[model samples]
Target: MKLIIRWLLLACALVLLTQLDSGIQIRSFGSAMWAAFVIGLLNAFVRPLLILFTLPVTVLTMGLFLFVINALTFQMASHLLEGFQVQGFWHALLGSVLYSVCSLVIDVALERLLGPRFMPPPQ
Candidate 1:
């Protein structure tokens, strides 16, 4: 139940990102939902690994490398999923920024409205 709501929120975030003039497109609600799930999974599993592997560079760059990693991950997810397309690296970077901001806003609103019972505590 909570998972479903979170997915819905993420879908909304994707829609909002599309509206932000970012080159992130989701052809349908189903695609958006699936892409959200895939992005969540990638962020949970792959992101940490990438962060760990790039720790030295991350440190050297004063955390700027994380933004690059985030954009790359977004592009990778776009590549893996059908019906979701991000044009180029710049587009992916813009999409990543939009996605992050929109998701954060949506998550906060959902948390406040639904409370912790409907939203899992942040990991």
Candidate 2:
């Protein structure tokens, strides 16, 4: 299904990130894959609530606070997943940026190759 494809791409992105940066580490592909899934889930579900709660701060910061939220979510995912570790706030922030870029690249490539039909329905 579309969800599975997205998760696979996320897993690939995470694997690529771990290889690119020493601050992020995944001991096994399975753990990386699971971490990707959990991260995606947290972003999809928990992140919005966080954004809403921090709306004032987000607006005050002109949306820059979202980066902090993203980093926190990345750290939360790392904590939830065994064999996946993010060193600190800086590492988490870097990892979040890297993950976003990698995921966007992977998604764009997959969309071009497989067509837009594989994408999840817009929420």
Candidate 3:
């Protein structure tokens, strides 16, 4: 199913991130997968709330404050999950950027390969 594929891609992205960043670590693929799921849930539920609360700053910064929000969410995920670590704020920022880029690329590739059915219509 699409959900499983998305989860696997996210796990792969996390694994790739660990290899690229010494400050980010994952104990195993299983841990990476779990971290990916947690991260997704956090992004889905917590990110919107954080954005809502930070609207003033986000608006003042022309939305650039979203980077900080994303990094904080990523760091929070590291704290909540076992066997996954983000060393510092800088690392968390870089890891969040990397995660977004990788996930975007993978999703685009899947959409292309699987046709329109693989991706939802853009709003």
lDDT for 84 in candidate 1 is 85
lDDT of 3 at 1: 68
Estimate the lDDT of model 3. Answer: 0.93
What is residue 62's positional error in candidate 1, in angstroms? 0.8
Candidate 3 per-residue lDDT over residues 4-64, each given as its tens digit: 8988999999999998999999999999999999999999999999999999999999999
- Poorest stretch of ten by lDDT in candidate 3: 113-122
Give the Cα error of residue 1 in candidate 3, in Å.
1.1
lDDT winner among the candidates? 3
Tens-digit lDDT track of model 1 for 1-123? 656887898887787778875577889988888889888989999999999999999999999999999998899889999988888888888888888987877778776877776446689
Give each model a TM-score: 0.87, 0.89, 0.92
lDDT of 1: 0.85
Ranking by lDDT: 3, 2, 1
| Cα misplacement distance, residue 72 of candidate 2 (Å) | 0.4
* Candidate 3 root-mean-square deviation in Å: 3.4
Stretches of candidate 3 off by over 4 Å are 117-123
Pairwise lDDT winner, candidates 1 and 3: 3
